[model samples]
Target: MDALEILFTASFWVAAIRIASPLIFATMGELICERAGVLNLGIEGIMTAGAFAGWFTVYAGGDLWTGVLVAALAGAMFGLLHATLTVPLGLSQHVVGIGVTLLATSLTYFIYRLALPEVTSPPKIEPFQPLPIPGLSKVPVLGEALFSQTPLTYLAFLTVAVVAWVLYRTPVGLAVRAAGENPSAVEAQGISVTAIRMGAVMVGSALMAVGGAFLTMSAFNSFFFEMINGRGWICIALVVFGSWRPGKALIGAILFAAFDAYQVRLQQMSGGIVPYQVFLMMPYALSILALILVARRATYPKALMIPYQKGER
Candidate 1:
């Protein structure tokens, strides 16, 4: 009935989780890339391509899961492209990333036009329904809000713990971190820096693709031009805000999602007391402020953006 009551409801949080799901996926993808010392500005385009891949597959009579797979594969291909250009070829990471984004964006649009030329309205697909956990859904306030989530949301949260473990406790995780911070030293340790970086980009882009697929298959159930908006860029910021850790990235994503969810509700409740666009701006503006607050405290990999060729400093 009132602001506090509206804010405290389970339904509101359910929306928050839904909005944050894609962001969580994107953040983790970028985290993986950055951990291996590759700054992926192609994230926006990769997500865009993923959305198109999923939507196109489902529209062409494939099932949702298959569409998801296609999306992941599509993302992986782009990641490989990025790795090929930036790693072995020794191209500039920034330039390659921007080129990948531009190429993916244009290519996706061209494919869309070629596939469905007579469409006046955007096509749609059946999205995943929320699955509520048995006992967990019985709790008040937190139950349905946290437990009654789509499968993708559950995966997103679960990934937090999994990634934290992988990064902190596993040898592969150490290699990923080491690759970004000191590739030369890592090379000296008998590891192929190129191989590790290549693998990281491939895996990271695949996850980023899944995030984009989540938007199409779960979040909205349809694909529109530039639907990814700037969420990919926001995710880049989130990685910085989270200090490249899964737990922190998840927190930052949820925080931004909360602002996003509240803004939508506020527009309905305020009845034009505030402009809707102003509400939309809340998340990005908050991100800037959050980045500013944490910028000084943030720690980044030492040798990030430096390419490693054998016997070269």
Candidate 2:
């Protein structure tokens, strides 16, 4: 078929949804922490840790649910590490985040190499199947694109609404916002900024890890050192692009995923007619442009990346 047709087909939208799910999950998690004034750069490490942990668990004869549970737990541990360094110790968020990423990524590789057999050929497990909603699956193109997805995909989108509600409606949500906007005021309310920040980091890290687990379990059923492939960085850019809102972040993720989906398809269909490198670079390039455009006007938590001390302001 033609390029336009290929881009607009039902299959394309399905691919877009599939490709974007992980980012949506990560972005949602980041939105939570960012709204609370903590900038987590350790997302890369968290995701990598999740991916390997999930893959390793499933590969070792555990069920998929258990594998995902282990992934989230692993991610939370990493998140706890980040919180310990940033929240209580008051370290540089960027420095500690990058360090976590380095440690987690290298640690995953080391663990995988030591634990698994036949390291050269990555092993696989039966990945989660798409559970198409009964009647909804029969609808037009939109049906399959939206409803016919793995359970995780549904959860990722559902999380957007859940996050929105939690951020804008609930009492703790108010505290989270307060923590970001005015920790001084939060302290005035007798709330502990350090505690809230810790919770946010732990939750965000778990979600980010699920995103990474999505790579190993859903996107492709195997472990690869390069599977994360900077998706975490793209997510950081997306956070700016989304302006720290769940809805905007979801939209930005889908947009980027659409470009990514199209890029992969175009490469296959064009068959050397187009430079493959250009297609490969599309998502990252768009992310850079998106960040540049959004960074100027995007609103952030007032105390973001600023270490909060109890008595000092």
Q: How accurate is candidate 2 locally (lDDT)?
A: 0.90
Which parts of model 2 have CA positions greater than 4 angstroms off?
none
Q: List the residue pairs that clash in candidate 2.
A: none
Predicted structure 2, TM vs. truth:
0.97
- Give the 10-residue window scoring lowest on summed lDDT in candidate 1: 1-10
- TM per candidate comes to 0.97, 0.97
Candidate 1 lDDT over 139-230, as tens digits, reads 98778788988887888888778778887899888888999999988888889989989998888888888899899888888889989998
TM-score of candidate 1 versus the correct structure, residues matched by position? 0.97
**lDDT of each candidate versus the true structure:** 0.89, 0.90
